[model samples]
Target chain A: MLEEAGLAPNVERKMRLDRLQRQPEVVGEILKEHVERQQQTEGLTLRKLSPGVKAMIWFLRLYVVFMTVVVVVNVVQTVHP
Target chain B: MAVQDVGRENAARALDRTRVDNARKNRKKIWLLWLLIGPGILVMLGENDAPSMLSYSATGSQFGIGFFLPFVLLTFAMAYIAQEITVRLGAVSKTGHAELIYRRFGRFWGNFAMLDLLFTNLLTLVTEFVGVVAGAGYFGIPAGWAVFGAIVLIGVSYTFRRYWTWERVVMILSLSNLVFIPIAIMAHPSWGAIGHSLITFGPLPGGWNSNTIIIMLSDIGATITPWMLFFQQGAVSDKGLSIKDLTHGRIDTALGAFLAAVAAMACIIATAPLYIHHMNASQFGTAQFAQALVPYVGHVGGALFALGILEAGLVAATAIATSSAYAYGEVRRQAHSLNRNFKEAKSFYAVLFAALVVTGGIVAIPHFPLEYVVLIVNVIAVLTMPPAIGFLLLLINDKEVVGEYRNTWFLNVLGIGVGVFVSLAGLLYAMTIIFPNWQL
Candidate 1:
């Protein structure tokens, strides 16, 4: 099971697996979580963002762009002048 | 997933599994804690980047250790409030921040968040290299070799192709940020003044003005920023933190905040002598600050100060570059784990290294206005934060994503409070810029 789980052969790996071998239920649960995590390629599907949230996100996008320009202009003026 | 990817990831997880197993059996809580505490510490100290440290230096020099001292603490408190959410989100969903945004909000909005992260990250990364170059200059090292050495050092950190190995290496380097504390003590600051400032949070010295406001915004930016959100969440997920690890995660984050806040405060205190002695450090660069400190801190302390900046830049560059790669790989659905070898996570490693090389190379260009980027990067980080907080709040509240981990009302209040505070701070900064004569 340890080899199948891709744990490379080593004394440490052997010790850990041995310890886990004593607790079959714990090993099963850990392996189960590991496999589930590995198989999960995609996560939660698209959330239907509310209109208010959409508007806010848009506002933030523009806010960031606007602020970036402001900062660049400010810095350029300071540096060159 | 390819077999190699799975094997690499499983190999990383194998370590986590063993540690967690030991934790569950009540065997070694301290050992488990030591193992689990990476992302939080990294994210916090990683944020004590070159520019941020310089900003703290500026604060201490310009304002001395009074109002801004406590203000710095408040900002880290805000950082803690915001970063704690990422821990819960990552442990529960096991998804990177970008992946969650892309998966839930779809591409359009996700791309905006990506733009904020990548743009600021690139600019911030450049400033970090600037810090490296400047700090090395203090030691009479030329720019070319400094940039080359920094890139090589960062590259070697991940050559192990193990997340745990990479994290541990960076954590040790990150702790060097505390070099500021000794320098601070060496400066011989008034402990009474420091305690009074912490307790009363007053004597803002110059009072509220455009310069003070900008410095305030910069200090806040230094602590809380968009990349921190993405980086910590992505790191938490990549570290394979499960629901059971949530307690350790929060503790790790709080400890990180405490340490980072101390380093930041120490930086301010170390430089406060400049303000006290009425020296004009208003425009000192990273190297300049170190050089000027020699009179107060002596040559050795000055060297340590410069080394702190150097380490800050190196550690933050690694983390910010990795955060960029994590976002890129997650959005593209490519193999992104640090556990994977370069062959398995080619695009991931490519994005990471490309960001470093390009930004590092830019620092070598003649007359590149590198200081301007350093000056504005922290402010830009602050401006881009409100929306990031908005998205974080939404995602953390989404039942389908965090389920049982959904934030309670108390957490919501704190999260929303962080968003409002950041937004108001940004607005206040804009106000100062737009109406330059405005005063509080």
Candidate 2:
């Protein structure tokens, strides 16, 4: 199963021992839950949060407002000045 | 045994995901750091444009290499201190310098800054075009063709959808600034005398006169100004630099300052030949300077001076026009990314194109006293620098803005010292302009 998951063989051993050492009871419970959940589910996928999404969205909104004002003002200023 | 293998697989997968996440974070930090350094180098080299070359030429002609050579280095140092704060502010706050000023200082101060930037930027744009035309004149290209060609170049650059491409192209062209280095070597200045002037900084070859003061102020103006503050902050924000990249950005600024000083000093040395010969270069342009050098250092030296002027104009126009666009984009909160397409940042692109067109067109007009415009634009840039410095220093120190990346006490002291010095220089320059005989 470790080979199927594509984990380095040594890393797999290290992770197993580390998790087991930290909380033997919790590890037993989590492993049981994972096995049960995996048997019931078709596939497992990783969940990740996209870093800089908020900043990108904020910048996009800012640019829209900024461009609108500049066009309107530049058109007006050039016409008047 | 099967159960043990399955459990091990589950734990291993979790660790792999964590490692992947950590690696992604590390890469993002590295990217952000690299982006922060781009603006300082671009702006400093851009500031070393055609008029700056002319200003150095004037200094060399009027005062020789005794006092002004070292003095140019001092002004560039002051410029470096003034510019470094913008790096911290932009990296920490993730906003342009102009946006910060408007938000914190209220409308009155913001309007003042915008007004000062607009006027100075416009005037400086005119001079940049003038430089283009003047350089073209050396190569037998008519002023109209030169201006038209420049407009087309600017238009095509704006049409590109990526900032990285634009920056790389401009940086490559700016590398031509090395032309001045060879020109300086061709002139063969006294090394011992040059070193002595740097160390002792004595012997006013021209004496303290009106001409000396005018040239001094022009040199100061050429080194530091309002656009640099706007340019670098806008660049850092657009590049999306975070606090992690601040050190890299500082290093970039230091390297840029060093390069700019070297270029300026080279111009002084290149022209020292005419100075030593007592050639009256009161009305000479870059072309004429090149021609004059032919008699002393042959055609190669002359060709280099002219080519350096062209490169200066080309690189500076790229930076100056982009600075104007950045300001427009920031104020309107429109698509400001160099990463954005023209459709995405249409107004930003449009403003940049229009500035280039109008500036080039204005220079093409027959019989315009273009030299005076060039001279005054530089004067105005220096005149408008003090307030820009004040706001930049304030923003960098604001805890809410810069947080842990805030200016150190020593940096703040250096910033204020530069501000005071610039303010005094601006006042003296203004007095000289008004009175025209205040220099003793």
Candidate 3:
């Protein structure tokens, strides 16, 4: 299957950029959004969401919970039946 | 190694040369961007796994070439909508979904999410191996030999230690999924009926029956699942995709969805003969399916169908195993890029191979309740998808992570729409299972 997927060359040169990643200026451009997120969400909580977003989240959560129960019950029936 | 190093490295080279080389450098970077196409295509096609093909097979055998012919197309559209966000998220945030959840949602919810992924991934992995074994059996191969052969093939790619090579290799193999199209044509299905089915709702035998809904959920599960989100996000991040690659990533994903959807519909159309002739194939394994289809599609078509199943399993096992590895790397903060040699990222490769070995080995074991695993795998996948989609939307919309790249109003509407559709399918499926004899 691996043979069937095919291959490419020059990968070694292009595959990893570890050496240049050590430069702060380079790293910032690459991960600036990610780092900013880590700092902003340092103590993030559900309560921080706007009320409208919070309601939507809760509604989606309710559907998930209800489906979980239904699936468990279905699995039990299948195993028993 | 981080991907942005290329940008930094390219700049330094330009400074060494004359300032007039900026345009040439920019062109080179654009060419490099094209190399980032593997993950999006791999993950999207990889979603068309063994059990998913089986679900499509069942859909064809049950509903023939009617209602589901177009329904499957719509499901892929939904998959495109949901997966497009992951591409943008990975490009902008440069983090795996699990790690993002761990950092932003707290460990409590992250652990819950991880548990969901682990359970479903393992179950789904086993089904892929089941497909490998069953399809190989059609050629009179033993299950153990088939499983062992698959492990070797899937394992060989990881040893390459470069995501570019591995992704290209998977891409090449994934192309075999198209074999089903020819097989479908060999059956000589009426093109007029097929076109009419798409234009009209469906022939839809036994309209909205319990079995119909169950099959619908299975089709939904086949197209959209929790692992898809995790797998694509991890692949995008690992491939070192950047904001510049977002357009290509979306194109790659769209192309994959189109190919996979075509392959899936072909599987259904090929099996439609069984339904028309009343072959009673609801209990079929892959080998049984091929044997049953021999009369309709000819011996060659039948053989290709079996080959499609095997290919599906082989491709999916590698993709699914990698998803687990990516998740493990994110949550544990271990080295995870496919670009790393085993010595550099032992745990990541170990987890990936471990998942493959355990799942593949389980299928080889005698009397291991393989039927039970196959039965609930797709169903359970859909049932657990709501939370995955919920988390996906929340992560994509979070301003802190994606910054100015957060979802637009249209995307939010589409994302929520997919979540609701999946949830409804699961709910309807559960109703049918709980009240099996209801003549609704």
TM-score of each: 0.94, 0.78, 0.87
Tens-place lDDT digits, model 1, residues B183-301: 99999999999999999997898799989988988999899989999999889888888777899999999999999999999999999999999998888999999999999999999
Pairs of residues at least 3 apart in sequence or in different chains that clash in candidate 1: none
Report per-candidate DockQ.
0.30, 0.03, 0.18
Scored by CA lDDT, what does every candidate get? Answer: 0.87, 0.70, 0.80
Q: After superposition, how far is residue B219 of candidate 3 from its true place, in Å?
A: 0.2
TM-score of chain A of each: 0.54, 0.35, 0.43
Q: Pick the candidate with the highest TM-score.
A: 1
Report clash pairs, candidate 2.
Answer: A62-B333, A63-B333, A63-B334, A63-B335, A65-B332, A66-B332, A66-B333, A66-B334, A67-B334
**lDDT tens digits, residues B229-284, model 3?**
89998887776565766788898899899999999999999999989898887788
- The DockQ ranking, best first, is 1, 3, 2
Instruction: Highest lDDT: give the candidate number.
Output: 1
Model 1, A1-81: lDDT tens per residue? Answer: 444544333333445433443444444455465445434525457888789988988887788777777776667657676
lDDT of 2 by residue, B289-356 (tens): 77887876678788778878877887888788888888877767676667666776789888888888
lDDT of 3: 0.80
Q: Which ten residues in a row have the lowest lDDT in candidate 1 chain B?
A: B1-10
Per-model tally of clashing residue pairs? 0, 9, 1
lDDT of 1 at B330: 92
